[model samples]
Target: MPTHLWQKSSYSAEANACLYVSTPDDATIRLRESDQPDTILTTTPTTLHALIRSAKAGQLDHLSTA
Candidate 1:
């Protein structure tokens, strides 16, 4: 019901592609990329944290086909 203000990561300032995230409420998180503003991904804080941890630990590298 409230407006969400998206914030770009400071690390992305010098990159052509950027990641933006917003929290419209305590239980929800929204994310979008600079190239695709209309398409958003929604998830919970816990899930997002787990995802980051996994990615950082290289647990997700094998899933990438590239």
Candidate 2:
């Protein structure tokens, strides 16, 4: 896979609790932790949108240990 531009989450800082995203030419978004560039997870746009919605609705709070 070609390397796409990865952007760190706005809420991320130098301390390392950050997620990075890259939107490749296929329109699927790639997600990875800033601290682990070798590992990546890919999701389609539709699924990504749904995840964002669920997160905004607080449905994913239980998944967060922090």
Candidate 3:
């Protein structure tokens, strides 16, 4: 089996769901649920930054509720 290597978030709870992120040398950031690190989704830095900004602006909550 392949290794499920991922970095843990500082705010992660022991029994609750969390996320893990891996930034590769090629500048791609990969993300996955901490409980399922083997399955990953990759995104560019610019896209990730935009998503973070949108999240901070509360735009994501509207999208999530839609």
CA lDDT for candidate 1: 0.90
Writing each residue's lDDT as its tens digit, candidate 3 over 1-66 gives 444457867777777578787776567888888677667888999998998999999887867745
Q: Which of 2 and 3 is ahead in TM-score? A: 2
Candidate 3 Cα deviation (angstroms), residue 49: 0.9
| lDDT by residue for model 1 (1-66), tens | 456799998778766679999998899999989988888899999999999999999999999988
Worst 10 residues of 3 by lDDT: 1-10
On residues 1-66, what C-alpha lDDT tens digit does candidate 2 reach at each position? 776899988878878758898988677889999778889999999999999899999999999988
Model 1, poorest ten-residue lDDT window? 8-17
RMSD of each: 1.8, 2.0, 2.6
lDDT minimum window of 10 residues, candidate 2: 8-17
lDDT values for all models: 0.90, 0.88, 0.78
Model 1, position 55: C-alpha lDDT score = 100
Off by over 4 Å in 2: 64-66
**Cα-based TM-score, every candidate:** 0.85, 0.75, 0.73
Candidates, ranked, TM-score: 1, 2, 3
Error of 2 at 48 (Å): 1.0
